[model samples]
Target: MKLKKLVLTGAAGRLGSYLREPLSKLCDELVSTDINDVGNLYEGETFIKADLANFDDMMGVIEGAEMVVHMGAIVDEAPFEELLGPNFVGSYNVWEAAHKHGVRRVIYGSSIHAVGMYPKNEFINTEVAHRPDTFYGLAKCFTEDLGRMYWEKRGLESVHMRILSAAQVNNPRALGSWLSYDDLIQLVTRCIDTPVTGFAVIYGVSNNDRAPVDNAKAAFLGYRPKDNAEDFAADVLAEADVLDPHDPGHMCHGGPFASVELGNSGLAGMNVIDDRKKS
Candidate 1:
C-alpha cells in the first residue's frame, strides 16, 4: 500500500476527531479540514478551515493531495434547502475538484440513509438499489452516482462507504448499526490502502451478528472489524422495549432517521462521547 498524501474533510466532527490521528499515519501528509477551528494539530497534519459548499474552497483544501476522505457535511435530516448547500453542492464540489486536481481516489463518507427506506429485515447487500429515506440521504445517492460516472468516464477511483453508525451503540437498534471508532478507522484505511478500487459502494458497518448488509464483495479490502455491539446488548436491551418490529425506525433501513423531521435529531440523538485531541 502506497503511503500517499491524504486530505480529510470534517476534521472537527465526532468521527473525524476519532479518525484524525490513526488516519494521519496512513499518509506522508494529512491536510485535516473543517469549517470550525481546532487546536493542537496532529503530527503529520495541517489544519485548514473551509466551507464544503464553496467550490473554490473545496478545491483549495484538496489541492496537492493524492486522495480524500470526504467526511464533511450537515449530518442530519435537514430541509431540502438546508441540505442543498453542504450535502449536495458540497459533495459535487469535492468530486469535481478531485477530478480536476488529478487526484486518484475519493473515499466518501456516505451514510446508510442513502438506502434508508429499505425494510429492516431485508438484510440488504451492496447489490440493492438505493431507497433513500430523507433529503439528506438523496444527496448521498447523488454522490454515489457521481462516483460511478467519474469512474466510468474519467477513471477516477471512488470508495463510497455507507456508514451505518460510527459511534458507541446506545440503543437496541444500534446493535446492528453500530460501527466502532476503531472499526471505522480500519474500514477507511482499507478503502485507502486497497489498490485499484474502481468506484465501489461498500458498507461501513461492523462484524455484528445482526449486520444488515452482506459486505462479502468488499471483503478483499481486508477490513475485518474487531469490535462487536453484543456486549452492550444485554444492558441496552433491558432499557429499550422491543419495538413493534413493523415501524420503519425499528423495521426499516433508516432506523431513527426514518421518523425524524427535517433538521431534526439523527447523530445528535446518539450517545456519542466525542473527545478532542490529546495534548
Candidate 2:
C-alpha cells in the first residue's frame, strides 16, 4: 500500500540521507525536513527547512502526511540545556504535530542507550525497564513513554526502535550489536508497513551470532535482518584486544555512551566508520 505522503525529519542526517530514496519509493510524496537545506533530491522527494525545537515548524512539515519518520535531534549526550531544545522539546513537537495532523504512525529512531546502563553480560528483551546512563538516553525513555501515552489516549501508533549500532562494524561491541545499512532499510520499511503496531519497543540489530539483545516480541513486524556482524568479528576482535572490563563503556550495552561523563562527548575514543554515501 503506497502512502499518500510521508514526512522524514533530520533529512540531512547520515541515516536520514539513506532513507530518503527508499522512502520516496514507498509514498506518493516524501517530504524531507532538516535545519539546513538538502540540495538535489530523488524523484518524488521534496525538502523542507524546519527547526525541530519549534512546535509550529514541526507541525508545518508534518501536516498532510500519513506517516512520520522522526530522526531529528542532538545525536549525542550534551548538557541538559543544550538537549532540551532538539532532543527533548523537538520530540514533543513531533508527537504533538503528528497527533494534530492525524498521522497514523510514527517510526522513531530510538537508541539502545535508553537501556544503556544494563551490563553487556545480561541479555535483555523489549520488556526490560529503562536504565538510561545519560541525559540523551533519558530523553529516549521519555519519548517512548510519551508514545505509549499517546497511543492509549488517542489512536496514534508508534514503533520505538532501540537501535544498538548503525555504523560500520569497527569494534568488538559492534560485533554483537551491528545494524547494517541494508538491514536498517528493511527494519524501517517493516515498521512503516506493519499494520497494527500500537506503541511498541523493538531492538534494531542484525542477525549477529553474538547479539546481546532480543526482538522476539516484535515478530509481528516481520523484521528479519539479513546481515551479520560476524563477517567483521575477526578484524574487530584482533584490534580491540585486552579491553578494560572496569570501564562502564566496555561493560554496558551502551558502549562509549555509557562510559562518557555527563555533558561530555561520547565520540571521544569511538573510532566510528562513517560510511554515509557521498553523491
Candidate 3:
C-alpha cells in the first residue's frame, strides 16, 4: 500500500539524505523539509525549506500527508536553551501539526541517549524506563512521552526508534551498538509500512551477535535487521583501547554520550564519518 503523500523532516541531514530517494518511492509525493536547502530533489520528491520549531512551518509541510518521517533534530549534546528550540519544541510542533492534520503516523528518529545511562551489560529492551544522559537525551524522552500522550488521547500513531549508533563501526563499543545504513533504512521502512502502531518504541541496533539491546517486544513491527556490526569487530577490536570498567563511556549504553558533560559534544570522541549521500 502506497501513501498519497508523505512528509519527511530534516531532509538535508546525513541520515535524512540517505532516506529521501527511498522515501520518495514509498509515496506519490514526498514533501521533504529542512532548515537548510535539500539541494537536488528526487523524481517524486519536493523540497520545502522550513524550521521544525515553527508550528506554522510544520503545519504547512505536513498538510495532506499520510505519515511523517521526523528526522530533524540536533544529534549532539548541547545546552538546554540551545536544544530547546530544535530538539524540544520542534518535536511538539511536529506531533501537534500531525495531530491537527490527521496524519496517520509519525516515525521519529529518536536516539539511544534517551536511555543512555543504563549499563551496557543489561541488554535493555524497549520497555525500560527513561534514563536520559544529556539535554539531547532528555529532549528525546520528552518527545517520546509527547507521542504517547497524543496516541492515547488523540489517536495519533507514532514509532520511536531508539537508535544506538547509526555510524561506522570504528570501536569496540560500536561492535554492539552499530546500526548500519541498510538496516537503518529497513527499520524506517518497516515503521512506515506497518499496518498499526498505536504508540511503540524499538531499538535501532542491527542484528549483531553482540548487540546490546533486545527488539523481541517489537516483533510485531516486522523489523528484522539484516546487517551486523560484528563484521567489523575484528579490525575494530584489534585497535581498541583497553577496557575501563568504571568509565561511563565504556560501560553505558550511550557510549560517549553517557560520559560527556551535559552540554558538551558527544560526537567529538565518537569519530563518526561524514557519509551523507549526495544528491
Estimate every model's Cα lDDT from 0 to 1.
0.86, 0.90, 0.92
Worst 10 residues of 2 by lDDT: 270-279
By TM-score, the best candidate is: 3
Q: What is the lDDT of residue 67 in candidate 3?
A: 99
Q: In terms of lDDT, which candidate is stronger, 2 or 3?
A: 3
Candidate order by decreasing lDDT: 3, 2, 1
lDDT of 1 by residue, 187-239 (tens): 99999888889989988888898888787877988889888888898898888
Shift in Å, residue 274, candidate 3: 0.8
In candidate 1, the residue pairs with backbone N, CA or C atoms under 3 Å apart (3 or more residues apart, or in different chains) clash, namely: 77-263, 78-263
- Superposition error at 132 for model 2 (Å): 0.5
Give the lDDT of residue 37 in candidate 1.
67
In model 3, the runs with Cα more than 4 Å from the true position are none
By TM-score, highest first, what's the ranking? 3, 2, 1
- After TM-score superposition, what is the CA distance of residue 157 in candidate 3 from its true location, in Å? 0.4
How far out, in Å, is residue 140 in model 3? 0.6
Q: Which is superior by lDDT, 1 or 2? A: 2
lDDT of 1 at 147: 94
